[model samples]
Target: MKETVKTKRRSFKHLVPPVDLTGRIERSTRMDRTIHAVAKAVRRRLGPGRLRDLLHGVPTGKPLHPPLVTVSLGCWVATAVLDLTHADPRAARAVLTTGIATALPAAAAGITDWSSLHREQQRVGFVHAVANLTAVGLYAGSLALRLAGDDRRGRLLSFAALGAAGLGGQLGGHLAYRQAAGANHAESVAHLVPLGWHDLCELKDLPDGRPVARRLGYIDLFVLRVGEGVTVLADGCSHLAGPLHQGRLVSEDGSACVVCPWHGSTFRLSDGTVAHGPATAPQPSFETRIRRDGVLQVRPAPL
Candidate 1:
């Protein structure tokens, strides 16, 4: 250490300020609050469970919004291309009409998507929606102007709309891919779980057929012993991480399922498959074996 030593310097080159979107952010936040209020009111009228099921395609076991949004984007692109290059006014009008018609379904799908998202995700989604709506308005105005003989003004407005839509699309991408909002959070749990089950509790400690809460290091697991076999799953529900241990166990078609206390999401005890929706991701399952000493041990199941 007395000799000359070179220290490796840390670089902050990749660090940058938050995207300079203060004005947009503020407007989006306000809008998000308004949307939140409206959504709450609507949910109250619709009933929470009904609203959740309706909006999230939980019954279908998939996200309904992403595909619908993609279709909207495609229609928007088609409209823009036609407006920019088509010599026939009829063709341009047709394309514009199609785009306008497409937006309604897109909005419906977006609303459904928004209902299942967390508060933070809803905030981001609000901004993304507003940006796309602005772009749609611009495109509509451009079309009107072009039809009224203001070709130059129409082209400018169309281009502006395109830019706004692009920005909105990018933000939506961040919300989905980057934040992993509305994504399956349980898929990675297998990797985090230790290879074998550590001690959870004595067999006598858990009531038969009732959900029992047990801890493994920092993670919480729910255990249900059926017959001689023990079923272990993440205690947190995949939908909103609601405590699964508090939920009731039901026998559905001869298989055991645990229903979430918060949102009623259900997971199968046999394989951790999602038996009901609002939760797209399956719960993490652990393989259970009785040790030679008669202690219960668990290991993460292979994918």
Candidate 2:
């Protein structure tokens, strides 16, 4: 008798293993060369100064991209609703044009922020920007159709554009929530410290004029000793978690500052306030006191 070979049945999961699409995109190495070149170009294009700062929301202590994106997306979505309801063609066209206009500034702010992120974040952000630009192009086509009196076709095209925009928005959400892009990385220090002063080190132990990393609880701190005074702030850079102790000390706007090594985000040494763009949020600072026993102690400064 001939023995039959057994064939194991394969289900969908067996045929195709589950994928972490976002993870894969973030971990991809294939795009590194292009990402570096493009990021450099974007930085060069945007340049440095107030324009970049305004776009980054440095003046307001928040990223302008989010609000600008909200307005642009809101207008586009409103236009689609108007079309479905058979609202006045003028109303539909008006909102569509407004969306197209607002998206320009939004794009500027977004790419400005993207250039300062880590390589992994930049990877996802590049795809996110592409999807958004595609949606904008589709919306432009829809607007042209509407202006040409092809109202029905325009409505259909707008709906398609909305789908593209939705995809882009989903990618953006991934960047914000999962990757923590534009989030203040050093904002958690206040809650982590216990009541009263925590011991850092003895006064004589810290070297003068040099920034050093110290730990308190689970938090890493940037500690600087100059003469008898001690300066302490959260070690994580507000922009991207680059160790502040690893940063270079400089004078910005005639004030003492430390420039983040990873992205050049400047934070004032006096109060941990930001002195440069690409980092809108201030680093959490702490008050220092020397105990009678010569041990340096620190506590969270009053907000």
Candidate 3:
């Protein structure tokens, strides 16, 4: 007797294209090439280690991009409102000028976040930067025209610039909220971890005053051996997941703290407390204990 067999075909339902924006968000290859060259030159001038730290915001345990972008957005909105309503010209000019002035610093913060991002994120960020820069130029021209007795022309130009800035802001929002670029991608790891200590590795494997990387199922932990005991923390830096295990262990008032190699965000080895700003969220700490067989074990702390 012949046996009947059935085969199932796989579907491509999950391969849907991303929602397209009203306007093209694609970056020019030539522009990207130029930016890459410039980034490399800047990196060389700053030195790899310093540049990496500057962009990483390790000290704050969070990426500086969001705040900077938010501030820029606020300035743009305020300036636009003032220009439209003919509200205090001095204040409008001040806000617009401040926004333009702050762009460089904000760009610095963004670059720090960008350094640790994936290739796709980097590409999106570069495009976002170009768009904002163009908007800034337009706004500057508008300001000049306004001061030169061309109020109507100035207002029109300002409105146009505001429109461009808004588009740039939307793209940035997409990069952050939608794409999760410059975000702590490993945040869900805490939820996945079990509530009890699990054998990680031998205690001796972790050197004194050094950060060691260990795995707890899907979660990566940065383990530090300070004194008689070991402390375990999320291995990925809260700022940009910059690999805290590569950071330096420093003593702050006789307490052990790990300094992130990326941006210098320091965390107490005992408990994940923000020793500094930038990183608003505390690093998720783990309950650490030694097993009977002299193995170091760790688990998620009680909520």
- Best candidate (score: lDDT): 2
CA deviation > 4 Å runs, candidate 1: 1-35, 45-55, 85-98, 140-157, 194-200, 226-229, 248-256, 261-264
TM-score computed on alpha carbons, candidate 3:
0.68
Q: In terms of TM-score, which candidate is stronger, 1 or 2? A: 2
Clash count list over all predictions: 1, 0, 9
Better of 2 and 3 by TM-score: 2
Any runs in candidate 2 off by more than 4 Å, and if so which? 1-19
Model 1 lowest lDDT segment of ten: 20-29
Clashes of 2: 0
In model 2, which range of ten residues has the least summed lDDT? 9-18
Considering summed lDDT, which 10 consecutive residues are worst modelled in model 3?
Answer: 22-31
Return the clash pairs for model 2, or none: none
Global lDDT scores for all candidate models: 0.73, 0.90, 0.72
- Looking at model 1, residue 258 earns an lDDT score of 90
Per-residue lDDT of model 2, residues 60-139, tens digit only: 99999999999989999999889889999999999999998999999999999999998999999988898899889989
Task: Assess every candidate by TM-score.
Answer: 0.72, 0.92, 0.68
